[model samples]
Target chain A: MSPVSQTRSPLDWVKTAISRYWGVVGVLIAWQAWVTITGVNSIVIPHPINVVGDLVFNPGVYLANAGQTLFLAAAGLILGMALGTMVAIVAWSSRILSGILVPLGLIFSSVPVVALIPVLARLLGYDVKTVLGIVIIISFFPAFVFTAAGLKSLPPGSSDLFKVFGASRWTRFVHLVLPSAVPNWMIALRLSAPPAVLSAMLAEFLMGKSGLGFLFRQSATEFATERAFGTSVIATVISVLCFTSAVAAEKFINEKWK
Target chain B: MNAPLSSAPATAPEAWAINVDHVGKTFTLDGGKELKAIDDVDIKIGQGEFVALLGPSGCGKSTILRLVAALEDVSTGRVTVEGSNPTALSRAHRLGVAFQDHALLPWLTIRDNIALPYKVAGRPVDDKRIAELLALVGLSGFEKARPRQLSGGMRQRVSIARALVLKPDVLLLDEPFGALDAVTRRHMNVELQRIWSEQRITTLLVTHSVEEALFLADRVIVMSGRPGRIIKEIQVPFARPRSPDVQRTMEFHHLADELTLALEPEGHH
Candidate 1:
């Protein structure tokens, strides 16, 4: 193996990282600059400084809300991933189960969860649970689709290798299936993470007494546009965090493995 | 179809590494059309003989390897490894296979890929044996290199080393060196011959190149395509411990020419 050391210093690496991702950094800077230069009412597009300041000053409020959303989303992510994987394996291994699930999963995936939100709110109540349920439904398809595709996507030669090597069912899953599914799992994770937060917000938007969504609606009604804009800005940051984490994971995998 | 040939006397009279007898196969695809891939093909490989199946593509050469490896079943007849049904053998450590594509696990380093047979079989592999294989394949320094970082030649070497790590009774290679450039292919041939002789394991190579068949094999088995059957078997009486110099010998050329004539269609022959 080659040495791990890179030519650049840590600070230099950070600079390089920012430079390499200039498109994203450029957008952020342009957005902040435009708001600062316009001198418009904070309601339209509050300056990034003010929005960030609001986050810092109201740390307890924002962090707690962010934490709540993350917890529920994480729960949904785990639940959906597990169920989807088992269902996918069953579908791939058995013709009868595959026939049953193939169309059923598609039909379940087709019906919009957003449309079901109202019914969910009535049944599960307009609370964190409803939002979590929404995330599960919305994220389920990617897990199911990717796992099934990943299982089937093993090259034609792979099955032959399996037979020659006498790979047990468990070994096949661990050695072949798991690594093959990593890329697809990442894809599903990326697609699902944002929906977790979005569904939480949607739930809050429909029914809430607290959280960023609640704050936005409260400010909107009171017409304190700056705070409403500030809350929205914070939500965008949460999204950036999700997107960046996925990107980082992808970079790590490509470098370390393939 | 010809009767199954017994193992040659040169290696051993009683012990056989591969015993494939009257093996036949037919595949019925999704459209319900029938495809006969092999037709009562029979070949016996002695304990240490290096046999090559030489013919044009689609001659069921690969199918034979797969059946012996127990990757696919012979719809009729039998393939046994040391008289045991290849599939029934609890551990596949008895056989190693390398196909056209070097199916080295992309996630593992070269060292790890070579060690996978032992890893998956849950047995402690002798590090010394692995090092010897790496040295034989000329891959000692690149153990930590991943498959993607390697050139095609290097990857194939890693695949071979991985196959040999288990020290199986038989080694099956299906067009293993076909994808390499001419220079690399020739180099690999010499390397493979040296390694096989040193290990003394029975080796079966399936290829379309008559020169490759002549160069690497002690005996060449040629097949006819379209309901694939063994058409001819030619023995190379060339001396053991073949090197690069052997490729230019009259014996090598003469054997290659005859096999070429046998492989060609009516007009070309």
Candidate 2:
């Protein structure tokens, strides 16, 4: 892929980008055309230009709420992943613990995390902490499931090698098992990141006083369609950023590991 | 430490480095069926002896190696290494092993992979020892290379370096070259012969190749498959520091033929 790309000129990069993102460009063009053709009221469905205009003109408002949402998402993601990995290690250390925790994990994963947000908000008093809790719960399932599976995926004959080397449980876990799980852990990260952003926004929309979700809700309630659409655009960009960064991180780690 | 099974009086206690006393292993399959992997296998190695257990695939040769490596338990008998249980030898960090898969950690450089045993045993890393081993395995200047960057043969060399890094009392190899191409395998055997001569650790190599067994072992114990049992034991006559040229000799061919014939199916034999 690199060799072929190197042979091509700068124009090819433009061509590749167009090929990759044509669908998005086409959708934007179609949305603009529909709004212009239907002559819809700007209050009902603002033009894309109006949405972009609101984003550019109201940078401070969007930035503040985006900052809050980003903080909640990033913090919840890290804490949830850390908690899940710790639980996975504990389960791996004992068969009885694994037998109990794995089924409970499956059950928890099966239920929709969004449904728990309202109940949790009621219990935790409809605050930022509840929003954070919702994000953490949303992100925890993949981390736990993927990490549990990853801990068991030892490289071929590595278990035998460790046993033959007289490695204690701690030694094996640190040197062998933990490193083996990294690739799978990265997968969990990539899977959970986008949802983490979305869940944080959802939680904020339901009951928070700030964040992209609350910003969207407040804008829509006030009939500020352009600001609401701008909020959505910002949320989408953040989600995409999270996904691409996770993918980049996964690629870098996989290259170094394998 | 003396072995717990001291009642076996046929041999003196300390002379044997590894003693597999009538060891048998039966694995219970799913649905309550029993599969006997090995049956009443008895073998003993003197200090510094290079013994080979040669058999076909699924002949339980690897099972015997596993028993000695303390990776598997013997059902009916005991396997003692260095006058104690195999586990004792391993726990003391006195056993080294290499397998067909070349089980070097992909994440580590060659140098770190070779240095792993020291880390596992809670010893400080010995840079000089690791360098010496890298040089000995003909892998000098390749220290920073990971296993993936190396060829199949080079990866095997790294695994061998890791096994020998601690100067272990016993080196157990189960088909260490079984996955290599024939030419590379032969070359590795030559390199291994040189390596083994330098250390002279009590070694037990398990292989299915007749030539490999004849070329490497001081004594080759051949086993039959399906409830594996020893079929023959032949003492190799080639002197130590044996060159690869000895493989072309008339006596070597005769021995190779004999072992090959023994390894055939029962009717053919």
Q: Pick the candidate with the highest lDDT.
A: 2
- Candidate 2 residue A45 Cα shift, in angstroms, is 1.5
Best by DockQ: 2
Candidate 2: which pairs clash?
none
Give the TM-score comparing model 1 with the true structure, all chains together: 0.86
lDDT of 1 by residue, B41-64 (tens): 878887678899987888888888
lDDT string, candidate 2, B1-269, tens digits: 12222234676645689989899999999999999999999988878889889998898999999999999999999888988889998998989999999988888889999999999999999999999999999999999988899999999999999999888999999899999999999999999999998888889999999999999888888899879999988888898898999999999999998998888976864
Worst 10 residues of 1 chain B by lDDT: B1-10
Q: Between which residue pairs do clashes occur in model 1?
A: none
- How accurate locally, in lDDT, is each candidate? 0.79, 0.91
List DockQ, one per candidate, in order: 0.47, 0.75
Interface RMSD of each: 2.2, 0.6
Error of 2 at B263 (Å): 1.8
| TM-score, chain A, candidate 2 | 0.94
Q: What local lDDT score does residue A154 receive in model 2, on the 0 to 100 scale?
A: 89
Off by over 4 Å in 1: A1-60, B1-15, B89-92
